[model samples]
Target chain A: MLVEIYLIAVVVALACSLPGVFLVLRGSTMLSDAITHTVLLGIVLAFFVVNDLNSPFLIVGATLVGVLTVWLIETLQHTKLLSNDSAIGIVFPLFFSIAIILITRYAGNVHLDADSVLMGELAFAPFRRMTLFGMDFGPKVLWSMLIILIINVLFITFFYKELKITTFDPGLAAALGFSPVFLHYALMTLVSLTAVGAYDSVGSILVVGFMVGPALTGYLLTHRLKRMILITLITAVFNSLVGVKAAFVLDTSIAGMIAVVTGITCLLAFLFSPSKGSIQAIRNRWKQRKNLKKQAASSHIKS
Target chain B: MEQLLALFSDYTFQIVALGTGFLGLLSGVVGTYATLRKESLLGDALSHAALPGIALAFLLIGKKDLVYLLGGALISGLIATALIQWISKKSTVKFDNALSVVLSSFFGLGLVLLTHIQGLENANQAGLEKFIYGQASSMLLSDVQLLLAVGAGILVLVLLLWKELKVFAFDPVFTQTLGFQTRILQFILSAMIILTVIFGLESVGVILMSALLIGPAVAARQWSDRLGVVLILAGLFGMVSGVAGTFISSIGRQIPTGPTIVLVLSLIVMISLIFSPKRGLIIRWVNQRRKKKAYIKQIEEKQERSEKYAR
Candidate 1:
């Protein structure tokens, strides 16, 4: 059970971290945060329509709403009324608060509660079985997340060049016949799908954590995009394993523990990354100072 | 109408309404500078950061006293802001990334501590969870008193330092050239923001507190460009939303006051965005359409004159 949980967590982390690299590089971490929260409304609305949480319609609805959120924010941005941050700050809370109110008033009797939405229960994931034609999958969440992970991997692999071009130089990419706008929405759809898949196990907050934390850490450690991706994957898997173990010992929320670990990992990289770490910079400065002092003393002695 | 009047007249409703109104007003005033500074999300970060402070205070003091909890929150919020400032300053990381790091880590710690508190066999721990989404209905008179005092203090401070703060907020280099202690003023302004966030936590919760901070300011910005007018309008908008949300939530058994207030604030923003005089979307659209029509008309007139001359 523990191994299954750990694998599921790693897959979820990988799924979030993949798009997260683009998001962080594009400086859209806050947009991911917005999508994570607003996607709740999508999930709840989908539940109302399908009358089941397991329906794939949930992912479709969430992706639509996620795209809508981006569109609304972009529209607001075009108006030149509010800054991008304010627009994000405004839209997500409106959608999220409405979702919360709906859940409390209308869905109180249902299993869709705010607590699980905020602090998802990973421990309970193992007990929920997915049966497909008399075959038992260990956990339903695991299979769903695996599917999402595969989709994310395939999407990234197929469109690697396009995504890279669009992400780094949208104007150039457009000039080269790739539609940056289309690619942007495609990436957002994948982000929303990944968020919804991870929602049941790690919740929204950890989804943001997984998205930004490893990506930022990877960013600090490397300059190359490919190397950053590799570093992010390693960081994500390592953080998940450590987080699960810490949660087991502390008997706390595994999702929260994972987020906390990811944060710590990022901080460590921020402080100690060989290329860009503050501590490294400081040490180099100290060394430079010492060398200057020695040169001054030696020159004085010669005089 | 009578029932509505009676609801307003009720003591508990009056307290909740007054407290939230003051909270809204305070956050509005402070949030203006925050929003203009592009630190609109700072309130979100600080509020989430305050969670661990509240939890730590309870654990250390072995009680859930409001004052002590708020004190702890204030301390932690300041630390979080300071860390954000430091990380952004000392490292190559941008401000947004630093904000994200502090926000998530602190919030994650808060969650872990909250779960730990829950595991402990203490009935008082039940009330602690309310801070997450806020239980405005559970507010007592004493809490209202604390809010009033803090709110008034912040208002007075802002009033006294209005010139310095304005200069600093608009242009720190100019303020420094004027020999103003910009760093001190910046610290004080951050302190005020942190205080407003802590005071609001009991009502707005950690999750939606930033909306209360940013919503009214954004709404007010649509109407006016002047700082004074924007601040005043933001305060008025916030007060209206706060009072109205309180009344509406009081009317229903299931409606949550915090989210209701946020919804009301968002509604105000939407209305202001659409209908405000200067920068409203509708007005802008109208102006564009008129300009296009006039341009086309001028072209047609020129064409007619050219044809007539040729004939």
Candidate 2:
């Protein structure tokens, strides 16, 4: 059961980190945050239709709402009324609050609640088994996340060039016949899908951590996109394993522990990464001061 | 009508309504500066950072005293803001990244501490979770008193430094050149903003408090460009939303007060977006249509003159 929990965490981290690199590079970390929250509305509306938390329709509904969230944000941004951050700060809460209100009013008798939406329980994931043909499979969350992870990996692999072009140089990509707008929506859809898949295990808030933290840590360590992606995966897996152990030891929310671990990992990279770390910069400043002192002493001796 | 009057006359409802109204007014005033400076999301980060502070305060005091909890939240929120500034300045990381790092980490810590406190068999821990979603209906008279004090302080400070703040917000370099201690002023303003966030957190929760901050300011911006009018309009909008949200939530037993306030604020924003006379979408669309018609009319008249000359 422990191993299964670990596996699910690892898979979730992988799924989020893949798209996270793009989001971080594009400077849309806040948008990812918005999508994660508004996807709750999609889940609730879908739950109302299907009346089951485990239905696949939830993911589909959530992905559409995620796209709508992006559209609304973009529409507000294009209005030149509110800044990008304010647009995001406005739209998600509206959608999320509506969802919370609905859940409190209509879904009171059901399993859906606001607490689980914010802080999902990963420890319980292991007990919710999936059975096929009267044979027991592993945890349902692990299977679902595995499938989503595969989708993310395949999507990233196939659209590697397009995503790279669009993320770095949208104008150039458009000039080269690739629609940056289409790519943006496509990426947003995938992000929505990832959020929906991970919602049951890690909840919405931690999804932002998983999506941004590892990718950012990797970014601090490396300059190349390929190397960044590799570092991000390593960091994600490391954070998840450490987080599981920490949560077990502390008897806290596993997702919260994971987010906290991801934060620490990013902080460590921020302070100590050899290429771009603050420590290196400080050391260089010290060395430069020493060189200045040595040169001044030599000049005095000559005089 | 009688029931409405009775609801307003009720002391508990009045406290909740007035407390939320003050929250709206304070957040609106501070949020104007934040929104104009493009630091709109700072409230989000600060509110989340306050969670750990609230939890830590509860742990240290071994009780759920509102004052100590709010003080702890204020200290942590200040730290989070400082860290955001420090990281953005000291490293190559951008401000948004730094903001997210501090927000998620602090919130994660808060969640961990909250869960730990919940397991401690302490009776005081029962209401700690209310800070997450915020139960304005559950607010005590003491909380309302705190809100009144903080709200007055915020209003007075904003009034006292109104000119300097306006100058500082519009152009910091100019403010510095004019021999102002721009850094001190910026620090004070940020502290006030953080205080406003902390004040609203008990009513709006950490997640939706940013909306309260941004929503009214955004709505006011649509109606006016002047800073003073915008501030006044924002305060008014916020107050209206606060009262309406409180009243509406009171109507429905299960309606969450925080989100209800947020939704009310959102509704105001939507209304302003479409109907506000100055910068509204519909108004702009109508102006564009009129301009197009005039341009076409001028072109037709010019064509008639050319044809008459040719004949």
TM-score of each: 0.95, 0.96
In the order shown, the chain A TM-scores of the predictions are 0.94, 0.94
lDDT of 2 by residue, A1-303 (tens): 889989999999999999999988888888988899999999999999999988899999999999999999999999987888999999999999999999998999998988887878898888889999999999998888888889989999999999999999999999999999998999999899999888879988878889989999999999999999999999999999999999999999888899899999998999999988999989999999999999999999999
Residues B1-311 of candidate 1 have per-residue lDDT tens digits of 99988887899999999999988988889999888878888888898899889999999988989999999999999999998898888876777777776787788888888888889998877788788888888889999998998789889998999999888888989999999998898799889889998888889787788899899999999989899999999999999999999988989989999999999999999999999999898999999999999999999999999999999
- The models' CA-based lDDT, in order, is 0.88, 0.90
Instruction: Kindly report which residue pairs in candidate 1 clash with one another.
Output: none
At residue B286, give the lDDT of candidate 1.
Answer: 98
CA RMSD of all predictions: 2.3, 2.3
lDDT tens readout by residue for model 1, A80-199: 899878988888888888989988898988899877876687888888899889999789888888888899889999999999999899999999999999999999999988998888
Give the lowest summed-lDDT range of ten residues in model 1 chain B: B92-101
Q: Can you tell me the CAPRI class of model 2?
A: medium
Tens-place lDDT digits, model 2, residues B95-198: 88778767888888888899899899888789888888788888889988988988898889889998899999899999999999988997998898888888
